[model samples]
Target: MSDTLGAAVIGLGMMGERHAQLWAELPRTRLVAVYDIVPERAQAVADAHGCLAASSLDEALAADGVDIVSVCTDDQSHLQPCLAAADAGKHVLVEKPLAITTADCDAIIAACERADVKLMTGHVCRFDPRYVACHDAVAAGEVGDVVQVFARRNNILASGLRIGPRTSVAYFLGVHEIDLICWITGARVTRVHAEGTSKALASIGADDSILSLIRLEGDAVGCIETCWIIPEGSANSLDARLEVVGTEGRVAARVGGEPFEAASASRSSRPDIVYWTEVHGRVAGALRDQLEHFADCVLDDTEPIVTPAQARHAVQVAEAIHHSLDTGAPVDL
Candidate 1:
């Protein structure tokens, strides 16, 4: 076998393009194939990465030498291709929420386990330095027995217009915090209470914001607040914050700071200072780091930092939260 791993990307949207570029650039990974429901999009990515534009997902999965598949499809459409990849004996790196339903997530997990293939969810927040460092602090006992947490991911209204129609705020925006809070505290969410409203995005029939009160094992309670109704003219694309209060101390983090700010006649805004930033003409920061880690783990035959089971649990929690939103009551997990 070659030292480099052969990879295929399914889905040619923004994230598919990113994954294609990362596969081509990673030290020991080769971008070998690309696929999408749209032929032109697949061909565009294939041409850019110097790979084949597979006629179908099966062709991509069965491409000679391809050992890894990156599933970048929409949140609700992740299960089928994942199962196909597992059947092809290919390792999978699926973009989060994993799936819209816990049963689908469970099927993906079980298929991968039976196929003896590794599966990792793309919960990029867990890989970000801001959140990763905080998680480490909590795990290191610096925060000493986390008792409470609060996390928020408020995006500009543009996101509400673009994404809210396809997925809920709970799965699309709240999943990050759901996964991160659990990862940091190493606890299972045992119950959830949530409320939501859709007036701001009524035209699209989508929820504008949601708040979830999640209770975890060991009695550690957390809040997940997600809103996609930030005005288009807001200073930043996102308003995100995470805080964990422990018995002995607390850790807080926010993605902010950059020397760049634009104050125009009509509006004002600030450039993002972290996560994925273009530097010296290429993508860098936590996005690249996470892809690097994925490729490295594949090459070294090691377990991923984010496992299928853990990702499944995150989906379970997100589903419960959605149920709570619907029933206007608490859900016990």
Candidate 2:
């Protein structure tokens, strides 16, 4: 067995809690501490896991024997904690949509490089069993030379409970599909055109849904549709579909099944049936596997599967989509 690495998780939200749980269970990791702006939440997780709850970022960084830090905070909040962890000489795993902007991601990468720390972004879908299988099939030329792709991720508003209106669907929902598309095809996005609407979530000051079309450098075309306006009680769904048209043949799979059902009520509202559990839970195994991989990289002195630079490119693509929507024109990357 590898030596246990003491780890700290910042941000005790749903993702943070999940990371703590996984760290507790992973034989190579020990959850030494947890930190959250909300002291109570951090304390709760620490207590449950027999660890400490650092009251501040400095305390967490200064804690003795912490070798790894996991940043599970909001997109905007990732920069500082990540920098501090790197400066403290700890390997860092940051949750994805690296940051709200490319500049922020660059800064985090610079900090990690300066500190000589291993930095891995949380593009956990690459570790997912289904996504892994799909990637393998594509690698074996099951799809031949890829030609076109389509992917979608949708969920009820319940999953949005912690996410505020300020968060865009492109960043929160679209980033996953964006990363997956690029990973599956091994091509760079060259141009993007997007449109978004906020009929139900206008009050939240964010477009609740988005549709995007992207042109890849290799002439492969892709589309992504994401939303969070489904009713509260409706099943939370993460619908992902990928179709790879190659010169010789084609391969495809739906990440989750779509089920149709009817509900009768006086008001008679029809809700879309949700197909996935919590978005995080649907990908929990992936998250755990990714963390283990990060640990292995640290132990073996190997590069991470998802580098900060690649993560920055994903952010760039997402930003391009946002720009495309705002300008009503295709944005070239």
Candidate 3:
């Protein structure tokens, strides 16, 4: 067995809690400390995982045993914690849209490189079974000369109310599909034209939704649509799907379905059929797989499957989309 790496979680939001849980659960990992701006949240997470609640980011990075840090902070708050961890010589697994801007992404990359530590962005959709299969099929040329791609990720207002204040729908929901389209097609986005509407979320300082028309350096064209204004009556939190078309064939998948469903007078919902689920009474799925990949890369000294450069490019594309939204013109990338 590989030596277990000690881990620290730097945030205690919903996603941060998941990271702490998995860090403790992984066979070659140990949760050593937790940190959050809110001490109570940090303490609660630390208590749940039997680890220390660090008083600050520095304390967490300097913890006696932590060799890995998971930066699960808000979209705009990822860079500082990442830089601290890298400077402290800890491998980092930062949640996606690594930063709100391209310059910040570049800075994190350079800092980690200088410190000689592995830096990973949490674009976990690439690790999802459905997306993984799509990538494999494309690699095998099953799709044969990719021609077009259509992807959609929409969600109910409940999630938007929480997330939209921190980042736009494009970065919050569109970044995953943006990364996936580029990952599978093996093409960089050369130009982008995007339009966003602010019907429901305008008052919150972000668009309710966005649609981007993307031009790849290669021949394939893409349209990625993301909206978070779905009604409360919706059956699921997300209405997500991905479809890729080519000369010889096409592949498509609906992102969320239910292995179980339930209803009450208040509302109805469908639990995830895949991604993250309790398998035999424990957390397991692509989220775990993504973390495992990061752990393995750190333990074995393998290159990350998702490079920092690619993660930076996704941020660039997201920025370009927002620029387009502002100017009503497509920005060449």
TM-score per candidate: 0.96, 0.90, 0.97
Candidate 1 local Cα displacement, residue 306, angstroms: 0.5
For candidate 3, which ten residues in a row score worst on lDDT? Answer: 253-262
lDDT of 1 by residue, 1-333 (tens): 579999999998978888888888877888999999999999999888789999999999988999999999989889999999999999899988888888998899999999998889999887788888998898899988889999999998988888988998888888888998889888989999998898989999898999999899999998999999988877888888999999999999986435578788988778785667778867787778878788888888898899887888888988898889889999999
Superposed Cα deviation of residue 155, candidate 3 (Å): 0.9
Question: Candidate 2 — worst ten consecutive residues by lDDT sum?
Answer: 268-277
| Arranged by lDDT, best first | 3, 1, 2
Q: How many clashes show up per model?
A: 0, 1, 0
Q: How far is each candidate from the true structure, as Cα RMSD in Å?
A: 1.4, 4.1, 1.3
Put the candidates in TM-score order, highest first: 3, 1, 2
Instruction: Give the Å error, residue 322, model 2.
Output: 1.0
Q: Give the winner by lDDT: 1 or 2.
A: 1
TM-score, cand. 2 vs. native:
0.90
Clashing pairs in 2: 235-274
Q: Which of 2 and 3 is ahead in lDDT?
A: 3
Badly placed stretches (over 4 Å) of model 2 are 258-284
Task: Using lDDT, give the best candidate's number.
Answer: 3
